[model samples]
Target: MHYCKEMLLIADEMRHFEGFSGALAVSNIEYMGTPNLREKQLSEFLIYSNEKEIVEQQQILFNTLWEKAIPAKQRIKEIELGIKREFAETIRDPTEIRKLFSKLLESAEKDILSISTPNTIKRIEKLGIINQIIKAANLGIKVRLLIDSHTFNEKINDKYGGELAQIKYHKLIKSLQSFVISMIVDESLLLVIDIKDESQENFEDSIGLATFTNIRSTLDIYLSLFEKGWHQSE
Candidate 1:
């Protein structure tokens, strides 16, 4: 019981500790379905203290792994500061961009602020982002949307009418002219896509290359723009 409990504890520790990737090697140990940790037959512990070759080989492997693993504390700091490397991925393909947007929305913890054109709104709704936005609102996540719509036309009003009151805040800024579609999650990750023309036959076909990043400076710029535009919108 003690040995089995120890292994389970180690696994839990590894989930929070990034500095180590560990494995337990038990000789001739076999199990079916859920392991019965109380079995007496699992008593023997393997030790290689006297085996020089086996110990030396394992030492080399351990050293290699330790060099490659990032420290748990360092990883925590990176996440807190929004400095993870994966946060800077550039997605160009239309399908992939939509997929990533959904993922970002799903993972958002606090809030979402977005600026969209009529075209982008339709595309995102078609891609199921509307449902995720509704879910986020239901979970108490603040959702603010600023649209470049001058009038309450059917294109922008009909689809989003039901959820307008559900979101934390939304504004219609018809005077703002822009071809860019931008979404920010929790004031951290930002996604921007440039549209060449809104009247294109396919939404995906009209999209140009875009990038997503959590860089602090870039985030500040987008936040400022959103705040300014939000204040000016009705």
Candidate 2:
């Protein structure tokens, strides 16, 4: 069975057409002056071409628009190739931040690494990030987590450590004094969360600013920092 629908760029000339099968008089505010399905005649009505010159002009316009509309895959390739701007943004919403985390996990092709506080790990647990990381690990992706040795009180740390011990790799930073969180995926994508408001014991209550970047050099710096912390933790 053939499944296809022909698209056309004739909205620009809808005003001059004389076809009365049916018409959707859209509000002027809603009109975007672009090709639209509603702009076409729903019935099998006929719209005779008034002149050859006008038809030729419309064809040219259609071809021009078609050339300018880039494919989604092509656009993504351009971004990955650094032809487009780097992915850099400050995120505040917890949901959006977790969503990006999930996306980063899914995008990882080789490894996933992170340096987070104990409370931040709990927040990530609440976000179900470890579950996704487990799935990624099952796919042969390496996973590494680095946390400050002073993340939690002895009781809480032991509990959390037991839970994380089931996972593959993790380390403790000896004097991990910073309250920052960083996750790097495949050495390509980097996420940095600054939890400067650590006065709040709960990670969720701590107001944090997040930055995401896909630049390799920026990610390398974070990876270097993670290495320093990793060695210190050992």
Candidate 3:
């Protein structure tokens, strides 16, 4: 469909032309310059064809576009307010996963819930994600970290144990076993990363498949798992 501002302006101007019809034409306007002189101005013109087949095709195109067109008011409102779209995606790149993880932590509003193995948490700490967690906790956002109790050690404690203690909203729990690194932010977004090879020390080398989503049902399931793990840790 032809949806150009120029076309609409041409259509409006065509109404003022003399002997207007479905076909296109060029017109001129003459004005009295003085007592005996006259002036003529060329009006803007649009080229067109009156072929029956072409006209029918144009009509069908316009009808299709008109049927699919949304109201301008609704479109304006969507632009004025932010668009809230829900999506779920599988991210395989480790660098991208870390970037998204840090972004979500920084954007957390009310709370942040997480479950990870000691190695995974250590990898995340090397990526500087723990700084964001600490920042969130300092801002009064509830921060919960659930780690595998079997792997908890002095190294992990020495790193974050003392720092986390000063934050009132930050809490850490040691659970039995946690296979994947999962996090839920503000109960609206979920990011899960699989531990492919725990032997690898680098965050990128040790991670496997990763999934991110804002689906409510998926978030609820993960939230339930985290709460159950929290209780077990306590």
Q: Against the true structure, candidate 3 has what lDDT?
A: 0.68
Q: In candidate 3, how many Å is residue 216 off?
A: 0.6
* TM-scores of the candidates in the order shown: 0.59, 0.56, 0.60
- Report lDDT per candidate: 0.69, 0.63, 0.68
Whose lDDT is higher: candidate 2's or candidate 3's? Answer: 3
Q: Write the per-residue lDDT of candidate 1 for residues 1-234, one digit (tens) a residue.
A: 344345555664322324332342322232112223234455333343335565556566556665655554455556778876434657778888767878989999999998887677666666667788888998889988887454324554576776655675445465554888888999989999888778764667768877899988999998998888788764
Model 1 lDDT, residue 200, Cα:
69
Error of 1 at 30 (Å): 43
Each candidate's number of clashing pairs is 2, 0, 0
| Candidate 3 lDDT tens digits, 159-217 | 67766753332224544365688889999999999988887889889888899999888
Instruction: Kindly provide the TM-score of model 3 when superposed on the true structure, using C-alpha atoms.
Output: 0.60
lDDT, residue 183, model 2: 87
Worst 10 residues of 3 by lDDT: 29-38
Evaluated at residue 56, the lDDT of candidate 1 is 58
**Which residue pairs show backbone clashes in model 2?**
none
